[model samples]
Target: MRRRDLLLLIGATAGATAMYQAMTRLGFAAESPYRGPITLEGDPKGASVIILGAGLAGMTAAYELARAGYKVQILEYNTRPGGRNWTIRGGDTYTELGGAAQQCLFDDGLYLNPGPWRIPYHHHAILDYCRRFGVALEPFIQLNHNAYLHATEAFGGRPQRIREIKADFEGAIAELLAKATRKGALDEAVSKEDQEILLEALRAQGGLDKDFRYKAGDDAADFRGYARDPGGGLAAAPSNGEPIGLHDLLTSRLWRGLQNFALYDFQTTMFQPVGGMGRIGEAFARQIPKVIRYGAKVTAIQQDDHGVAVVFEDLHGGGSVEEATADWCVCALPLSILSQIDVNVSAPMKAAIDAVPYASVVKTGLQFRRRFWEEDEQIFGGISYTNLPIRQISYPSTGFNAAGKGVLLGGYTWGGPNSYELTAMSPADRIKVALDCGAQIHPQYASEFETGISVAWHRVPFTLGCAGEWTDETRRQHYGNLCQIDGRIVLAGEHASYIPAWQEGAILSALDAITRLHKRILASR
Candidate 1:
């Protein structure tokens, strides 16, 4: 959505320095001093920190650490900065192709407040970022009906409970999944037995496990055998697969660890920025020294007793690998994407990176010629649906003037689809699917789309998906890998920060790691 639309929404609706920040700047978001290489303030010779990736997580960490006198070098895979937290511009106006949406969310009180944009609570790095930069968060705008799922076709009475929503899923085997969870997680402790049963069910459904960890890719197929087969519903398939994989069936609670903020859990939600989500990333980007590099990809990472060396590949056109070394390095890149990179880290670090997988998200952004669908009532955040692939159709340009007359609509699909598939699809096909869904709600919008494009994060090479997924094995293994490698390779980013997968989580992770590294550096002095 564009800017002018927001002004028409409600005229409508609407923090301090945070403890983690070094110094507070009024109105400006605080940038944490702990983002990059470890540095002690009193030293004449500064420390060198090689940061991988220039996304929000990497940028914030570099910003914080550099301010405290750490000389930093950032290597990014994308042609531009901002990894999953992406911003796209057609001409002058822009919209995010990927990332957590939020801005200016910390205050001088060191107290955190809700901002115009809503980020997942699990993301500790974001709060840490706000504290460092001193951006204050306002209250999250109350959404309508907490629309878990809304459609014009009318599904029926409201769910008696959240489980009912689960009951109504399109996957006929959903009930079997719920039943399997009970029989698998608790009823039967035999892990291997549970795996087989789940696989049978998933195979019966159109499901495929991208990671071959548990021989999961074997027998991956379409959902035909058990499409609500009552007999199959009652009987459990033989439980067997990789013991370390997700149960064929599971509960939504698994995601709480990732989002914690209940953002994805609720179906219908439209968040407008108090300022704008872009401002948040921009704020973090600003605090770092102007030396930050863009379009640099790290091809090889090697470390020795002296320091760590990194190689970069230019993303724009001509290619030359550049190398730089640092006393310490904070790797803020997403593990799901970074796993493929040739980094000479230990087996455990590599395994850890491979362990926490991300969810593939296909977001379709549509811009209209005019207020095509905003008739009857001036609608901003439109209906969320069960009938469509896209969860919600929102008009983000609800307020503001200078931003202009624009509308943004999207179709979000998670891991249910295949990897590397969407990237191969044409932009027209992606937009057609999104608009088709939107038309289901307001039948009037079937053909009025102006220009549309889709974001297939799974194919982004540098970011396999939009955010973290709630796989059984993934949840089990995320936390143990948070520490640095032999006290040198510090980890930062939404993935490394223990915040699941939100921008705030990225900031907090950077702060925590930086603070810890900061202490380590000071102690050495």
Candidate 2:
């Protein structure tokens, strides 16, 4: 099915779509018992594994480690687990507060915003997990999210019509895409990730038409056409265990075969979980056997002959010094937070994580007594590309008995007046900043909430920012350097994976760390 139709089917389901997509693509239809837990239970003590965070990555590693028969304990600083895939609820529905962002765009609009922002069934890890779990799949959706470019300079609350900047915007992007398919290769089966990445590289270097806009327009379809590449839904290469590089396969054809769709928003799309994205996290948590040490901030990790000693602080109360000695440890804390961990790792590991550049994103949730957007005459939910302080907003709480209107209005806010100053602001001030800036997106934003809380990861004690990666080669190498030193200190986080900042990355990295730890545990015997 087209990505848009898939989205509609998903949104129609409410919020359970993400997990469904993950499962379906991975081929999980009936591979395992859907209602039961699949664990890796090994023996304790022989290879006690201490997981440093309860985020997806940490928890994933824990589940895999546990089923392997290793005693596992997960330590986290948050009062709750799920790390970035956090969910906040009002009525019956809960919206992801941290990492997972949902959308309302449709099939062809997979690359569009407020939906499948850019999930192509290309990542082997995402597909594999989905199949292993038995979740179903759906495509994307397309509502009013048809946008080609977006101007950060401020247009208005609603997205500008495509006719507004036809010349400099759509014209250039269309011409550019045509050039990719024209390159001569890509006709044969190749990994989508490599193809898109190569095309993007060429597009950026002026390989195509250079008549591009200095700034993106409301219709990000033009610029992000290159950005909305579905992940090369692919399997790992036999030789390297990495997805096959497009450079290896499609290098001969170039971009001569691609096509551009009409609904072109650059935002992420996702089928509204029949329930919510939160369901996916809950699923993983249920499957995993873990004791999350909430509010227990890891301070240090020291390694020696026997194993590793993890030093931590119980941030929930009076400070106390506690240490857990484990045969191995997996550090699944955020890279930003990891940098703050009191223990000093090797200089290279520290430098690598420290060097990753994180984009500051503000996620603010506004609770409304009713569903204002649903009442609006313009369209249904799946609001995208608004010219406001908020990047995108969807009525996430549309269907729920307890939530009343059950409205979830959220946005991705970046760079604006006092954007930098937010770091020093108080909670009240930050909320005001989000609300004040948010007001530009919709007046309801300024005056809507009875009361709301804005969780700025930038201001979060340990987490500094959102999904961005390091460009420096040295920094990238640092991620690999951080592993269990002889099965004692493992590192797992968004930063630890090739695809950093995404939920899939967190789980994938954890799996890697867990696999290694599991091997060590078994080998020791």
Clashes of each: 58, 90
Q: Show model 2 residue runs off by greater than 4 Å.
A: 1-45, 91-143, 146-269, 272-276, 342-345, 386-388, 395-410, 415-418, 427-449, 483-487, 520-525
Worst 10 residues of 2 by lDDT: 106-115
Query: What TM-score would you give candidate 2 relative to the actual structure?
Result: 0.61
Candidate 1: tens digits of C-alpha lDDT, residues 1-525: 443343323232321223213123232234333343434456525878888878776886787677778888788776555666554444322223344222211211111111113553323345555656665554332242222344333434221112223222223243345445545554554367756666555544424333211232232212212222233555644332221123321333321211222444222232323444555666666676565677777777778777888877776656777788898888887777577778777776677777776766676666654454344324444334343566555444344232233555456555564323554565556667777767665555665566665667665556766665546566566555545644567777767643455565676677677777777766765
By TM-score, who's the top model here? 1
> Candidate 1's C-alpha lDDT?
0.53
- As a whole number from 0 to 100, the lDDT of residue 72 in candidate 2 is 78
TM-scores across all candidates?
0.61, 0.61
Write the residue-wise lDDT of candidate 2 on 213-244 in tens digits.
Answer: 22343233333332223354584322211111
What's the true lDDT of residue 164 in model 1? 24
- Poorly placed runs, candidate 1 (over 4 Å): 1-45, 92-117, 120-142, 145-276, 400-404, 418-424, 470-472
